[model samples]
Structures are given as structure tokens and as C-alpha cells.
Target: MGQSSSARHRRNLTRPSQISSSMMDGSSKGTDLVQEDGVIEGHDYISSIPDDVLSSIFNNLSTSDRKISAVVCKRWLIVEGQGRNRLVLNARQELLPIIPTIFTRFDSVTKLVLRCDRRSVSIDDESLIQISLRCQNLSRLKLRGCRELTDVGLAAFSKNTKYLKKFSTGSCLFGVKGMNAVLENCKYLEELSIKRHHGVLEPVSPDFIASDSLKTICFREIYNGHCFGPLIIGAKNLKRLKILRCMGDWDRIFQTMSTRKDNPIMEIVLERIQLTDAGLESISRYTNLETLHLVKTPECTDMGLISVAENCKKLRKLHIDGWRMNRIGNHDGLVNIANHCSNLQELVLISVNPSSESLEELATKCKTLERLALCGIETMGDIEISCIAEKCVELKKICIKGCPITDKGVEAFAWGCPNLVKIKVKKCRDVSGKVIDKLKARRMNLVVSMDSIQIEPESVVDDGGDGGDGGESEPTASSSSSNGGSGSGSVFNTRFGLLAFTFRRWSIGGGGRSV
Candidate 1:
């Protein structure tokens, strides 16, 4: 009886190849024991895992890897479909033909990024509509470089996404119809970022009702300003507005805002926008503003800035940038702002050199100032930095660029500002790497960086031949010139390398060239 039972057990145990086929046919249970290559193994453990637990494991994988993982088994395919919440299909234009199928696979996706290459075929209305119909849970969508996307496609997509909160698209051919579609349908839309859209030339009627839920709006490299007027008027809850490299009369938008007594805007950013003192005066009506960014607006002067400071008492962050040092001026604006906005925590100045008196007053009055960024400020040196360190007790971050500052200035910051956590020094040739190293050594936890400067000079030199044959061997003139040529070549290569490295770093680290 024992021998007969053993024979039956051997007959029941199947090979690995037969196990997969039998499992698909529902002939084998997941808990069944199996024999693989004549070796007995325990019951399948992976499929026994709960869906939620397996989903968590798949969440950590890349989108491409997840697609590949789906083919492993039916269970993995199910997990890939049910678990994915974020989908980023970057440069996958080849999949444009079957976008609906792709969307069907990832039905649970909430945040979607469909970024295509400039040279590839663009996604059309049908594809977008398919996505909108399927991915109802999508909250954030970023469409980049889809040049063929028209107002029809945009409207079709926007009409379906009722829950979308944030939407950003660049290099599209959409116009007012598309904008109106989104504003009319997505009542809860909080943020909209439109960049390099060529078709936004026509005006949006002021009577058009837009969702008041918009809090942030960003326009970058757009040619027309007609659409902005309606958006500014409709976005009653707007807090942050960033306009960069956009050509148009932006003063009208501010003028419109000035008429609204209940404007809830707290943060305003005007980068490379053409506006004069009148525009600034119009913006001064918002007394509740907490953050303001004015970068590369040559038409704005000290008078315009002073108006903003006098009115916006609750201001905490301020960034003023200019194209040229001469275009910006040092005046009582800084002092007055410091006096009024005592709670100011961050200040950024570019191309505008603040006077010692003004900086001293700012350091004294704005005791809560924590982050300071000075770029291309020719007058900023040891005195200004020292004053900032001494008075701004809460200071934690300092970024100095293109300023002729030396070790003395930075050393003062290290000694005076005990709370200093990050110091980024770039294009300040006078500050050596040795001083940075010393400062880092002094404050072990402090983050210090001297851009493009080699810490140890000896590391780049060749002393192998010079050490042994020093006394008797006198160097000839030709050899010296050859060495000089080599040195010059090395210097050129080093500078080129450093410049390339700096540019690459800026492209990645710096958000944009606007400020």
C-alpha cells in the first residue's frame, strides 16, 4: 500500500513546463507542489501574495521596466495595470498609433507626462480623446513638444478631465478655445503652465467666466499678451503668476487686477516682461502680497520698486534682477522695504549693486532674513557680506555669483553667521578653494562650494622630471617656450572643460536663464 501511494504521488507531480500550461488551463492550483527538472519544490509563493502588497513592489520600477515586466505572467500584467498611478511616456512617439491601447493598460494612472521628440509625429485629437475617456482619475498632465496638438484636441481632452488640478503643455498649436475649454470644464484646476504656444494671438473676451480655483499661472516664451488679461481677471484665487520671455503689454493685466478690491494674489513674478512704473503702481494695490519677483524688467526703476515695498507690508521673499548693472539703481527702495517688511526671509539681487548703507539698513531692519542671492552685483564685497552676517541672525543660505569677493568676505560669513548651512560661490575668482576647504573644516555640517576651481593646484602639475634633475640641468629657451605652449594648451583645455561643466551644471541646476 505504501509503494502504490508513492507511485501516485510521483504521477501527480508535474514538470516546470507542464506546470505553466496546466496553471493557465486551471488544472493546477497555486498552492500545489511542483517538480522542476526532476527536483521537488514547495508551493508557488509569489502568486499567493495579496494584490496590494504586490502592487507596492511594482510601484518602485521604471515605466519601461514595468511594461517589460507585464509579459512575465498574467498576474504581473494585472498588477502593472492596477498598481500604476504615475505614467511618464517620454519620447515614445512610435507608440502614438496605439496610444489608446497604451492608455487602456495603465487605467489607474493619475499623473501622466506625454513628452514627445521635436522630430517625431505628434499626438492627435483621437489619441487625446481616448486618453481622456479612459484615464478619468488623472490629476496632473504634462504635454511637451506636441506641435500638432490643436484647440480641438486640447478641448476634447480638457472636457473629460474634471478632476485635473495641474496641467502644463509646451510647443503646442492651441489657442483661446483650448484655454477656454480647460477653464470652463476643470473647475478644480489649480495650476496652468503654457510655454512657447504660437497660436495664442487672439484675445479672450473679458466676459468669459473662468474657474476661480486657479492659484498659479506660468507663461514662458509666449508671443502674445492678449490672453493674459482675461486669465488674470478670472483667476480670483490666483496667488503665484510667473511670466517669462513673453512679449506684450503686461501692464493691462495689473491694471485689471487693481480694479478688483478682493484680489487674493500673494505671489507675483514678472521676468523679462515689458512694463513701466505705471504697471508697478497698479500691482501695489495688492497689500497682502507675500512674495514678489521682478527680473530683467528694464522699464522698472527704483521708484516702481519703492511703491511695491511701501504697499506690500507682508512681503517675505523679493527677487530683483536686471539685464545690465547700469540699468538697475541702488536707492532707498531696499532700505524702505527692509523697514516695512520686517518678516522678510529671502532677498535676491541681480545686476543691482546695493549700497553699503542700504545693505546695512536691510541687515539691521530685516532680522528674519534667511536666504540671500547676489548675482552680478559689482559693489558687493566684504563690507556688505560682513554686515549681512552680523545682523541677519537667522541667515542660513547665501549664493554669490559674478561678484568680486575674496576669502575675507566669505571668511567673515563663516565666523559671524553661526547658523549658515549653505554657501554657493560662483564666478567669484578672488575666492580660492583653500578658503572654502578651511571653512568646510571649521563648520563640519556646513555645505560650501567654490564653482570651477580646483582645490589642489599641485594635482594638475607634473613634477616627476623636475625633482631629480634640478641642480645641474639648466632649462633652454626653446624647451621653456615648448613647456609654455603645453602649459597654455593645458590651461585652455582646463578652462574649456570648466566652462562646459559650468554650463551643463547651470542647465540642470538653474531653473532658467530668466533670473
Candidate 2:
């Protein structure tokens, strides 16, 4: 009986090959035999897919998954080589060891994204030089958060990668000198983003300003601490210019470039800059502007904002923050924006008080307004918000932080704005969970955040319940007492808190807060 069973098992294995001619006759027994082979032969299933289809599948995988997929088999390795156009080498310490080998396999890469954690990983000069030597067909290169790249590495890269078009090095440690080397060599570059480098030298000179293909330039958090003349002059044909945390004689820079009628800048972002009315007027002459962001420009007054609204008629999006308009009434600047920029779609105004009438004008005139953010405006009531909600039917997002609004305000929004999808009320004390629940029921798509209540600081109470003038009333004594009092009271008390508070009060009362 055992010999007979062994012969039956061997016959079961070779039965499909023996009856190949019978399978062509469409017999039920042959079909069942092929199905059984398919269930047992898992490798054969993947082998049926063509190389081109496998390459397309590999292109959609993540970097780690792609590395694993490449090692599945010789066929998969070839498929990975065929899909070399989709190579994104994020700089991991482990990945650094295999980069050379990976580059050797992918010799025809077109778009390469090199991402590194600036705080942890350090990309040295040798690595960049190696990359430039190996990847010749590299066109789009994005180096995000790479800190160890200096001028020598950039010079090597720019000298090698001549076909580069879209280059973005965001939050890198490259100084202006390194960037100067890159701009000088990469003449075919189109889009550039250089963020958060506190260097003192200029990046581009007069000799490197002749690129007709360049479209976007972002200088975010680049504090050169000197004049921006050379940088601005080099970006004469830039359509988008973003200057964040830069200090210089902006008025002179704007005046010098205002007369260039042949060159027109389309978008400008001046965040936390010291800009005056003259600088704003000079920038307003660019009639082709589509987007403008003046965030945290405390020195800019309502007159400057009014001038921008009146002049830049083609403006589509406007974001302004920390512009104290106590001199100009609530409706003046907003009225100008409503009357002139009728095509406005996105508006963000923080700490700027606008009346209900101005909100009505904005809602009625700017019918295309979609996203609105009014943060830190303590005076805006439910009536003004309701006016915006009722008139601006296209409004999709409303972010109100540090605003004095209650459940009544939430009710007004629920009733007036039927199309509202998102509402963020951070630091809004009066917004209750009940109101949020009501809105969630009415508008199922609505998203509400109650982060205000959870983020409040704990209030302290005095030991003397009668609120008498205790020793804790003194700023020095209060801080020293809270710090568990270093035994030498006089020096520690006077040096730490009392003197600092006194100096701060004196400086504020002496009218010394100016640019």
C-alpha cells in the first residue's frame, strides 16, 4: 500500500505536463489541475507581469520599499534600473553608506530629492561632490534641511549639474557665498528656495542676473544683517520674491528697482521686515502683482496698506499681520481694499480692527473671497462676522485666534455661513463644547478646534487672601520666592527681576518703541 501511494503522489506532480494536449481541449479535469498549480506556484504569479509593468509598480513605492523591491530578484533589479527616473534619496546615516552603490545602478535619474535632517545628519563636501560626479542627468534637485553643505560642495555641484532647472535647498546651512557659487554656475535654474541662513554676505552679484528662465525666488529667514542691494539687483526678472527676516535699507532698494519698467515682479512676501511708506509705495508700482504678504511688519501703517490696495488692482491674495492701525480708522484701509481689489480671494489680517461696514463691503465687493483669517482682533463682534458669513458665500475657511467671541458668535456662524467647512478658534475663551456639538450636527463637514480652553495658563493666588501689600507684591521678592530663594537675598533679588522690570517699564514709557 505504501509503494502504491508514492507512485500516486509522483504521478500527481507530473500529470499537468503529460496532459498539455488534453488541457488544449478545455477539459474540466485539466482546468482543475492548472488551478492547483497556480495556488502552489506563488513566484510564477509575479513572473507573469511584464518588466514595464513591474517598473511602474516600483515607481510608486517609498524609498525604503523601493530599496527592498530592488533586491527581490534579478528581474526586479532590472525593473528598478529601468525606473531610475523616480529616485528620491533622503539622507539617512545608513543610506549614506549605500549612496555610491545606489547611484551606480541609477545612472539616468532625472528628478532627485536629497532630504537630510539638519539637526541630526550632516552631509559633507565629499558626499555632494560624489553626487554631482555620478548623477549627470539630474534636473530637479531638492535638498531639504541639509546643514553641513558649504560653498565648496555647492561650487562642485553647480559646476557639475549644468542641466539643473528646479533647485530648492530649504533650511540649509549654506551661506550667501555658497549660494553665490550656485547661482553663478546653474544658469538654467528656474525655481529656488533658500531658507534660514544667518550669513552676512551677498549671494548674487550684478554678473549673475541674466537668467530669463528663472521664475520663483524665496529668501526666507535669511538674515544678512546688511544691505540687500546686490541680491535685489540680481533678481530683476524674478516673478515671485519672498524676503523674510531680512534687514536693510529697503526704501533705497525699492527706489532703485522701481524705474525698471521692463522687469515686473508678480508676487512679494515681506515678513517681519522694517518697511516704511516709501518702500511700500515703490513696490506698489508693480502692476502685475497677484499675491502679497506683509506679515508682522509692525512699522507699516494703514496708509501704506491703503496705497497697496489702491495701486495693485490685480492682487488675488493678501496676508497682513501686526500692522497697528490706531491712526487710520477701522474702515479706511479695508474700504480701499474692497473698492480696488475686487478679485481678492484669500485675506488674512491679524491684529487689524475692521468695522461691520468694512466687512460688509469686503463680502459684497470681493465675491470670490474663499479663505479668511482674522486673528488677534479683540474688537470684532458677531455682527461683523455675520456680515462676512452672510455676504461672502464662497468663504470656506475662517481662522479666528485670540478673538473675543462667545457661543452666540458660533451660532451666528452656523446660521449665516452654510458653506463653512473649517473654523479654528484658538484662545477664544467663550466658545463652548455645546456650540461645537450643534455646529457638528448642522454641518457634518465642519471641523471645530477647542484648543483655546486646554492651552490656558494656570492662575496664581496670593497667600494673603485679603490682597494686602505683602512682600510678594514686589517683583524681585515674588520671583526670588518662587525660585526657592538663594540665601543671598539682596543681590539675587535686585539683579534678577526688579532691575529688569524697572528698565523695561522705563523703556516703554519713554516712547522708545520705533524702528
Best of the candidates, lDDT = 1
* Local accuracy of candidate 1 as per-residue lDDT tens digits, 322-441: 656354547577877877888887777777767899989888988888777777777888888888878878787677766767788888776777787667676665666667667756
Could you tell me how far off, in angstroms, the CA of residue 514 lies in candidate 2 after the best superposition?
39
Q: Best candidate, TM-score-wise?
A: 1
Worst 10 residues of 2 by lDDT: 462-471
Model 2: lDDT to the true structure: 0.67
- Residue 63, candidate 2: alpha-carbon lDDT: 72
Candidate 2 residue-wise lDDT, 1-515, digit = tens: 55798666654563556368557777644543333344432225688898888888987897789889899899898779867774666765456567788887787787777777656776677788888888876777877667777877888888999888777766676666677776777788777766665543653455556356677776666566334456566666778777777766567777777788855788788877778878888888888888887766766777887888888989987876654545332578888999999989777776667777787899899987877777667677777776776787877667665566777776767766666656656545555667777776666656565553212112311111211111123353232221112332232123211222222232233222000
Q: What are the models' TM-scores?
A: 0.78, 0.74
Q: Tell me the whole-model lDDT of each prediction, alpha carbons only.
A: 0.73, 0.67
Quote model 1's TM-score. Answer: 0.78
